[model samples]
Target: MKRISTLIAVATLALAGSSFAADRPVHLRGEVTAVGAGDFVVTDRKGTKTTIKLPEQAQVLDVSRSSQAAIQENSYLGIAAAPAPQGKVRAMGVMVFPEAARGLNEGHFPWDLGDRGTMTNATVAKVVKKASATELEMRFGGKAQQVVLDKDTVYGQFVPGKRELIVVGAKVLVIGASAADGATAANAVMVGRDGFLPPI
Candidate 1:
């Protein structure tokens, strides 16, 4: 009887310990009304208002950091002081992918393209015509097509078999990163030529 009693006590204590640990809380991403010095009061995904403490600037990940410091530095939004275990993210801006955006996004829309997002392979079939160095008049499907750039003002001119055909018989797959606002062309930002971007 005493041995059984002791086992019960041990199991009871274990259960109590688990319950106590559960008392600890976690923060979820939500809408922010404003920003302040060290802490920001945000409406959590659950629709509850919670205050989160911001780390020092040095802890933030400047996503904008790129070959062109002046141009890319501005794009960074800052990541967590310490990266999450496995494939998790603690802060914002590190930009791993749908995983990083999962919790924090809460239901938010896309922020911008090329900021650690996915890409699609779109082929440039033929140049229906030429608009300029910045834009393209290509046919992707059986119909006429026109592609333009808002930032670089220069379309990628791929080499052809015998001519600078601009877009004829050229099959260059493009990685269409998430647009700034939506999934459609209405939100895509014109990021420069494709290259190796550093990891977060």
Candidate 2:
């Protein structure tokens, strides 16, 4: 009886671990190549294809082209960045949030872009343009941070969108939940608009 009970406890822990793994967020960036009744296929930049299940009520946002000129003082932004020298971070991509999105997820957090990547959703306190790059002083949750953006950094703006925007040929950044069986179901999708690809 003692051995049987230990085996059951071990099984329970294994099941719990699997459940937690399945709940991890999956991020995908690609172009829609096919659309079906309830799902779509995306071909990533590396030419790998993935089928993603889209729930009926998944949140969708349209990402439009944005430029460095649009990033001004006091602009609320979401920046994906990686560690840099001198206690600063280098911007991988920057998203200028719409007025309605101010304060949305406003804080610095770990991101999946890489092992040390981070995401900062904050309000710009100051902007400084250098000969080769731009620097932003951002504030969120009473904390201030600095990030550097260069010409290689991509930019976009988020707007409201619907399911219809998930059609073929559209580029998208998908945030989804992965299942134990390796399937992914989208929780939110950011679709690029007007031939612009989502930068983050």
Candidate 3:
């Protein structure tokens, strides 16, 4: 009876922890203001400061400055966009994936950016430059999507990075889980290098 009670108590604690982590998902984009032992502070564009805890196993990716010229035919990309006219999407930001990271999360799904924001991870089939915008025809999971990138679109490329990249004044995009007490813990952190901001 004692062993059974102990097993039940452990199981309940595990379930509670999982539920707490799942209850709140955090996505933050901002500039790092301070880095401390196992935690950091970020201030968003609107000056909202948030403290984020970094776990020992948190994944980090470095984003480097990129331009439209880097987006070529057959290139893989992760694009954050919103629906536009005639069944197309307007690119808000584009992330050029490295060749080794091709086909990562290849799908089109709803995003958290805005009311109608979506994220598409696909391979470029064709590219066309117009007077005011660059158009890309992309394919993923047997579906096609048209994305238009205008002058305001941001671009970056992903590269391997270490925890040392997290420093003051560096731009970052973090995906984390929030506990019931409102404490945020990072699951992944993307840091921009050389003054480049993470585009998405």
lDDT (CA) per prediction:
0.24, 0.77, 0.78
Give every collision pair in model 2: none
Top TM-score hit: 3
> Per-residue CA lDDT of candidate 1, range 1-200, in tens?
32333222221111212322423222133344444554444453356654444433101111122321111211211121122234322222222221122222112122222343221111233322235322222222234223332232211211111112112222211111122332211000111123212121
Per-model TM-score, in order, reads 0.20, 0.84, 0.86
In the range 1-200, model 2's lDDT, one tens digit per residue, is 32333222221111212334647567788899999999999998899999999987566776788888898888888888899888788998888876555665678877756559888888999998899988999999999989999978988876567789999999988877778788888767888997677776
Judge candidate 3 at residue 68 and give its lDDT. Answer: 89
Instruction: Identify the runs in model 2 with alpha carbons over 4 angstroms from their true place.
Output: 1-22
The per-residue C-alpha lDDT of model 2 at residue 35 equals: 98
Model 1: lowest-lDDT 10 consecutive positions: 184-193
List the candidates ranked by lDDT, beginning with the highest: 3, 2, 1
Tens-place lDDT digits, model 3, residues 23-94: 576778999999999999999989999999998867677778898888999998888888999999999888
Badly placed stretches (over 4 Å) of model 1 are: 1-27, 61-200
TM-score of 1: 0.20
